[model samples]
Target chain A: MGAEYDQHVAVTDLGNGGFAAELDEGWVVGGGVNGGYLLGVVGTALRAASPAKPDPLAVSAYYVSAAVPGPATVSTRVVREGRGSATLAAELRQGEQVRVTALATYGDLAGLPDDVRTTATRPPIPPLEECVPGSAAPEEVRKVARMMARFDMRFDPACVGWTVGAPSRRGELQAWFRLNDEREPDPVALLTVLDVLPPVTMDLGLMGWAPTLELTAHVRGAPAPGWLQVRHVTRNVAGGMFEEDCEVWDSAGRLVAQSRQLAMLPR
Target chain B: MGAEYDQHVAVTDLGNGGFAAELDEGWVVGGGVNGGYLLGVVGTALRAASPAKPDPLAVSAYYVSAAVPGPATVSTRVVREGRGSATLAAELRQGEQVRVTALATYGDLAGLPDDVRTTATRPPIPPLEECVPGSAAPEEVRKVARMMARFDMRFDPACVGWTVGAPSRRGELQAWFRLNDEREPDPVALLTVLDVLPPVTMDLGLMGWAPTLELTAHVRGAPAPGWLQVRHVTRNVAGGMFEEDCEVWDSAGRLVAQSRQLAMLPR
Candidate 1:
């Protein structure tokens, strides 16, 4: 098993509320580091700074500039501190340039009372065993797809044809996702894996890279052990921008994490 | 026309990256002030601070505590500033207690090239003229609904059956939205209006107030000056957690602003 996911996300003690993170070349997508991977590093730093609350309830990251693959430093400022929750401001800087800036809230997920219950439905899709493997990339976007190989993703049969030059009237992708590496799924790993999928535009016959402007992820509950299910879809593409809404469910069909991002449409 | 929207969102000049804001009692959603209304005031501060870039691209607001209706002061720290964009961190304090914290990015919307052509579709629903208005609250929730009366919302006929005790198999709400108080639509108004719709859980027969834990909004482009349509839906409501995905379209049928929030279900 590869150590890329764990090594790339692990942060070192720089002391004084500051830490250093490395942007592995393997995680690069289209010349820049993956936005989710960047946040995973920052979230790791935030978690280390405050051991009291380990789970990141929410992380809102804005990409300021391209983070070239290499060493990056992250520093955090505590906005507010309470009994079981803390709001923090963090930035990952490559030397003098701030590559990514994020505002995050961390809380005790284990202690959160999830008492209210209702029949939550997953979107209509086939069973995991019946879906097709989906790591193949288009000839032009193989550079991105290769980096995405770090995550083991198998797509629903109906959604996998878009990569083979089949045109779709809608923007949708459903898959069972887990890291190719042996590391188990956690909140930080979930953060990195959430954005590793191909752009939904590919299904609708659009090309080129779509960089994220702002991404916000909310950890609903601690992910259960096993392959997590993810559904990524976009309903609107307007004014040179499109939204990616991701719903991640645990192995038991419980929703554990959800994210939404605004990304620039490929030019 | 009532000046409540403008007066409530207007920030007084305090200089030195600081501003004074007050929450009018009429904007209270329950026992606490509305989270979106608080951010709108903070958005006003950010816009005033950077007149060159008047459009708000993103805002991630975290509710630290219950903000009482009255005077509040806001202080901002500049995270990063560039030629065309700026990301700032701001916090709201009622007195000695910090009530709200947000990280916002503002930019010039006019100069951004919207050359990417896309065919984005809104959810299946009736047109604005065919839907009925939706301000009716359960007898016990009138106190909260009174605060929501500031917005003129017409719900999709299919989703409104929940209010009358009809069971809905899924959670969805599509409505034509605009400020009932007659304030023209802008970025801040768009932010406030995006979250003003009734929670989708109501359609699932869930009761009580669903308070937002965190909200992130992305303004696509400056909205055309007219009624902005919105679609609010939740794909899952598990373990007392749910996500509200909102897409706001302008009068010209262009997607303008989008938002996602994680809220706690009332016990």
Candidate 2:
């Protein structure tokens, strides 16, 4: 089914060091695909075109309209090239009306000296054996999980029972996650993972349904070994919008990347 | 100089449920004050007029021109009234031209029981004695720090010294900070604090000058106790643009808000 969904989003190599992909209903909500899955498809396409050592640093997508999931296309253009960073702009469209537009960046690896290093504290890692898996995962997660079974995510047992905790003045969460599918690690895949991290954490805390309005991430260092640690926190949930921030650390404790998202809660 | 700067950009209440402020020299650099600060001042003015509690959940601003900081006015209008959220649109004008436009929301606080609650781990707090004060000493700290002094910030000595650690990555830093200002805090102040947090943390780590380009924050809960903790990390630095995400927690470790910002590094 995942492969079937992947097949629907077609990739076009612009040939001029750029690429594009089309996302149609085979990936839309009513058609069984959702935004999350489409995002995955887009990430995969961008990864396929990146250099072997491509490291995705940031991606910003503007949703122009709801992608019905049948047939849509994404086109990417290289906007700027620099020694440290490269910028690429990608657009998802259906027949002419743009559905989504994204600007992503990739960077070459340049190690910082020890004196320049800095790191955020990682949340306590829970033993997978002790933690219970997530309860009825969101439809989006379930769909993505089925389509792309590359990551293993273990939610705290507290998250599954619906006994999560009261919304304190400060919101906080810790989860264990890593790629389930083994392949040459690509920056696009890493960014896709970062985009998904906030929803689960938000779900574990919010009283109502929270749908992401926008998501932005920054890749800081080289990818870490195997397992990735995600520490996510929601700072405020007012109006219909909520905000979440996450820190992604590699198994070795190096800060790999960080993400922030704006989500609109469903009525 | 700082007081003079404030006067130049001082926001004025326009009365009749509207407010205005001028963009002055201090607010502009190459051209204008940072876009994020412009939105922040307008949001602050809107909050002052509404009877509703001031908790900024989401805001959208468009850059029209470089606002001359010396004198500007903000006019806010109620866009919509919903069962749970109130939407407002604010315009910042300098003489006749609309310099900036913004949309903001404040939700009615309906105390609801939280279903999920988990706090992310915070960095180990360094003792005040061991921590180095911010780059500005008593006088500079007093002047520039007004925007930040409301927050209790403890920088890791390594960051202050611009030293990298084993797990450190370039363009990243981890520090603990909370609102320490004595004034009754409002959503505007929260926004101001959020804007101030990232630059300090990033500058301390990268040892580079960083200025904000855009900031979007989600206010999850009402302001917490006097203290709030923040963890800021820079994700990427490329194309003269950089980004950072900050997670804010109250004294109890509950996540209160989180923010993301796009910035330009000083050439």
Docking class of 2: incorrect
The superposed Cα distance between candidate 1 and the true structure at residue B78, in angstroms, equals 3.9
> Model 1 off-target regions past 4 Å?
A114-120, A123-146, A155-157, A160-162, B82-84, B114-120, B123-145, B154-169
- Per-residue lDDT over B25-119 for candidate 1, one digit per residue giving the tens place of the 0 to 100 score: 87777778887788788888888887877788888888788888889988887777877677777888998888878888888888787753545
In angstroms, the error of model 2 at A154 is: 3.4
lDDT of 1: 0.79
User: What is the DockQ of the complex in model 1?
Assistant: 0.49
lDDT of 1 at B7: 78
Residues A1-267, candidate 1: write the lDDT tens digits: 356687878889899889988888877788688887888899899999878888898898888888988889999878788776788878899999988888888888888876535345677778768877654555556565456667777788777666667857478888888886656788877787668777777776777679887889988788888888888888767667788888788887777788888787887
Residue A37 accuracy (lDDT) in model 2: 50
Q: List the residue pairs that clash in candidate 1.
A: none
Chain A TM-score compared with the true chain A, each model in order = 0.93, 0.74
Docking class of 1: acceptable
Most accurate candidate by lDDT: 1
